[model samples]
Target chain A: MIVTEKQQLKMLSSAEMQLLHEGSCSLLSRVGVKVTHAGIAALLLASGAQCKGDRIMLPQDMVKNALAQSARIIQFEAPDPAYSFTVNGPENQVKFGTGGQALYVVQRTSNGWVRKSAGTDDLKQIIVLCNQLKQVDFITRPVECDLPDEQKDVAKAAVFRRYCSKPINLANLVKLARLAEVLEIIGNRAHLSFIISLVSSPLVMDSSAGDKFVAIVQKDIPVAISSCPQGGSTAPFSEVGELLQLNAELLFGFVLANVVRPGAKVLYRGIPITANLYSDASPRWCQPDSIRRVALAAQLCRFYNLPCCGTAGVSDQAVPSAQGISEKVLSWVYEAACGGQYINSALGMLEQVMSVSYYQYVIDDIALGIVKEKFSKAQSLAISQLALSAALEVLGCFGIEPDEKMEAELSARIRHIENGLEPYNETYIEDQLAVIEKAVNKSSSTVFMKAARKGLREGYLYKGARLDASLDLAAVAERLESSEGLGT
Target chain B: MNKDELLEKLEHSVVMGHLDADDEGYDGSMEGTPGTLELLEQALEAGIEPQKLIESFRVAMEKVGNLFASEEYNLADMLASAECVGEAMEIIESKLQVGNSSNKGKFLIATVEGDLHDIGKNIVATMLKGAGYQVKDLGINVPAQAIMQEIREFKPDFVGLSALLTSTMIEMEHVVRLIKEDSFPDLKLFIGGAPTSQAFADKIGADHYCRDVMDAMNKLEQVSNVS
Candidate 1:
């Protein structure tokens, strides 16, 4: 049975939400969004938007009409039906999944945990772990594989599609050359998955992201339009101002996608990141403001009846320490309780979402189980649960004796409830770890290993082919053979 | 404000990331006060030495950099301070006579090919310029041929290559190899970036690895004294 939670926390009042939406609509109709791509600009212009060069001023009514045409509930298709889910709408449930583009992986050592650049082998391990864990509902590109700069995204998608049967959230396919291969990998499962297109915050749509977005949407695949407006840096410092800017950016994409193909399946994702005033870092999962902003984003998504996607379970701590675990759990509770339907980075992330930890993956599963259990609806009490006769017999208030068969039935039922509540303990976590270990030891999925073995060759060929130059492949192969393993 | 007061305000402006007299975006308290660039020009107009004016900007940047290191200031703060320095440098560049401060050294800097990041490169360039080095910034994604061409014409005492992307750092090796093979074989090559390390620098045959702008300046001083 799937676990679901209904949000009781209203971070924003109705009037405030209306004002925020109106402010965004004003920003759209007034300041306008900068569309860097010529084709996107033309499309918007043709669709009744006022375009002067790169800036496209979208009419408020046009935006509202576009939103009206969009799907309230879009199905997130997966390779298997078990992993399939729906996002947006009132029926959306809080689901945990892996988020991506991490450059490094954390590994345990005698001293402590050390971080190393993630490569193809780490990518495989990430997918395999996500697949083995019943907790992870879907998979995004877990870690950016250390492959040739030109082919990493395409190669990662290919490898992930082959091994992981869950739904995938494709990272921004910036390179046009890799699009065809990625599309082929997605094939008929377009509904089961979606590609992401990011907008440079403070109201700028990158031309490359724009082109890739159109390309994906044109193929009938759902697209997630995500914008991360960093407070005090990219957007306004005030929370209200930041949300307004974030909403405006997301609405711009919604209008653009709908203009291209009306009623296109789009997930309105807002990542309202907070900038650390003392540090140069844009902390992905930090304090009061980040969680508050997340809740507010969900509230806003509820206003639009769209599936809310945001970041949670992130940490500034490098390792799985008290600070990391506390921050992850806090963000998880707030995001889940406040109606975040598709919470990104909810599992297996550490170091401010820069690195993925294998151990942290198991720990997060247990944490997720606890949150689900705590937030799950209370079971209704029945006459059997009252246990009036058993209570009277135990208290010696009645002359009648308790039935042994009924007593045994109650004990069995009590045991089932106790078992359900005990998944968060260390023993259960260890069991999940052992399952992952067994899966890895089995080596049933050799696709990632195959990719790792070909890393040097593919990198060399891609770069060499670009240069129109030839290398002594035999010599390079000998060097690769003698080297230490990738992602070590 | 007096000359000393003006100079102190210049330092405060950068620390606060205030650009001009009316620049009120960051801190409202800084509004209506003369910013770094305005005070710098005022100092120059008040018969202060161009060297002294440049020194004030340098001291402000030092404070900003320290704040950055201590987590008291962020990237936006550093960037805003850099913008103030850039504006002041442009103002002071016209007043200063050439060859007055050329004795320290001359340096050419560029982000290696296929890498578009130049935040670190720009900061280093500004710091080196303030440190009395004649800096030629080739901007981002500069190919090896451009560096070679500039080297042939500019004849810099040192070349600093920056690459933020690990994949593009390979291009730095090519640049170093080509520059070493050129006629100016003694031209010192220094490398720095997010992915660059002392080990990578040594393997790429660079003369030095700069952990940050201050490190680069310290190594530059050492090179100047030795040469």
Candidate 2:
């Protein structure tokens, strides 16, 4: 786990937080939320909410009760229990993972980088890469595959089980009904993690998304209501408006999820992207404005006593160039310093979350290791006081120089810290490439077949055996075993 | 007020983003002076030339762009300015023709399909209009067929495509190909956005690659002069 030091910065004061909370509460009770799913509307109405058409005005007391039902600390279980991560409470740590639903696979060519439509092999390769990278604590469907639209969800489930053991966080790209089929297969498995429950921008939950969340909650799965409110378009142009609307949306989800299953694991996932004033398009997440907005959202989540999910380290560059490096590094540093228990979209994504690169994934894993070293470790105040007294003693002696023994000791300690620092050089990347090569070599026919058969089992492993022709698991294993190399 | 004075106030209103006397400017000031739309009415009632009024609108919008570029203003400021220009243009569109048509020509712009970003597109449209070109904005998520339809009906001298997302930027190539294959062979085509570059323009067979709104204006002027 990535540890953090005590925070010395506060994005919002108590009064400001109180005002925002109260404003959201008032908005929830007054303007209400438009829930497109009739079942969810019925649940809210049965629980003392007033409904006018699609809008459901939840009572403040009911919202508070729902808030009270949240889990302070959510243990995200992986297939291996050692890989599981907690959401909030005393963890005070950050975990990095890949996030995107991009259709393109940005591959390095002989000339330069070129973006091509991602195939199932590309998706499987991402899972294999993340599985070996220790920095990636969890896995999400990083890139969209080239499977037919109807077969998307089952394809993801089949591929995810075949390669990865880390907890999975799924996007909302799959059709709700098909997504339910996929989830039912992984529902009882030890590796099944939370789903990214998305709500519409500006306080509206569409029919399908509402039903999806309800089904997810019915399965007793954890849901993180990740809302993306672009500053100028879907949300109000002002920062205040963005903050208020984002908070209101999350709170609305919190209420809805609890109403579906009280005490369900719900995380407040806020992704506040800033719009470029000239184009009204969001720049990369590295912008100071975007970071600041996310920090405020984290602070609001803290006030509501809800776990926060955030995105950082994504770049708008199409290639793994200097621009991509700087953007990803700056964003990781900012989010690490600020607040976020689980930093989504922290690796392997580019072009504003529109593409993923295998080379970049390996490079980003190395970059995150460097950034995590800067995280200050927690120390006892008494130990700090003793060090301070020693400093004072040295200061009391003014111009007196230390002996050679003392000087040597100080130099040794400095060297220790310096030695721990690993530069993200070419050799490091080559080393990671070697690791990927080793991983590919190990995907033997026997190992691949075993995992495939286990994942394709009845309700215990997966549901619905409507496998696609392109996803021939045995053929994929054969191809990987016989291919020359990844051609990195 | 005198005609020149009224026009000046109209320009100031656009720069300040005062839609009307009732528009509370970005600041707390509610200067009771008539806004750009209202002052345009006053200037027209005073029998001021429509081209002259449009010229003032152009100047004000340019200031808005400059302020935004310099970081002195923001989205709300430029949007307010554009909204003001839109309101005034609606009033004088019938009376207005492309002013100084000997020097400039009409331009059609759109954000290609699958991209819902129009802020950059809006900036270019407003800047082109202010630069004395009759601009038709097709707004966001415009399919290639729709853009081709507009090109046929509007017969613009230039077609500009904007795409903020890389996924949607691919659509620009399709749009460009369709336009080239269609009857509009002489139609000058350009592309711009956060993800677009000169290399992309070359690969897609577009005539010009604009880095920003200012670059777009400059290139359009150069192309207009050459053509």
On DockQ, the candidate that comes out on top is 1
Give the TM-score comparing model 2 with the true structure, all chains together: 0.69
How far residue B207's Cα lies from its native spot in candidate 2, in Å, is 11
Clashing pairs in 1: A77-A192, A88-A307
- The lDDT of each candidate is 0.65, 0.65
Candidate 1 regions with alpha-carbon error over 4 angstroms: A1-6, A149-154, A282-284, A377-488, B1-18, B24-27, B59-83, B95-227
lDDT of 2 at B61: 77
Alpha carbon deviation, residue A43, candidate 1 (Å): 1.6
Candidate 2 on B1-227: residue-level lDDT in tens?
89888888888888887778866554536457667767887888899987787778778878887887886765556666766776677668655553343237879999898665565687677656656677888877799999989888988999999997555667898898888788576789989987678888999899999987667878998998898
lDDT digits (tens) for residues A1-488 of candidate 2 = 45435442355566767766766676667667767677778888999899766678878888798889977787778866678877774456778888887767887657767888777888888887787776898897887666655787788887787677788876553566686677666654445645454455556675656777777777776667888766554554334556766787888888888888888777778877655543333443544456556666776776776776767877867766543554465566555445677778898888777788877776677666655543443333322232222322322222223445433433332222112122223343333233222222331111111111111221111111110111112332343344333432
Worst 10 residues of 1 chain A by lDDT: A460-469
Model 1, residue B17: distance off in Å is: 4.7
The true-structure Cα RMSD of candidate 1 reads 16.5
Please list all clashing residue pairs in model 2, or write none if there are none: A279-B119, A279-B120
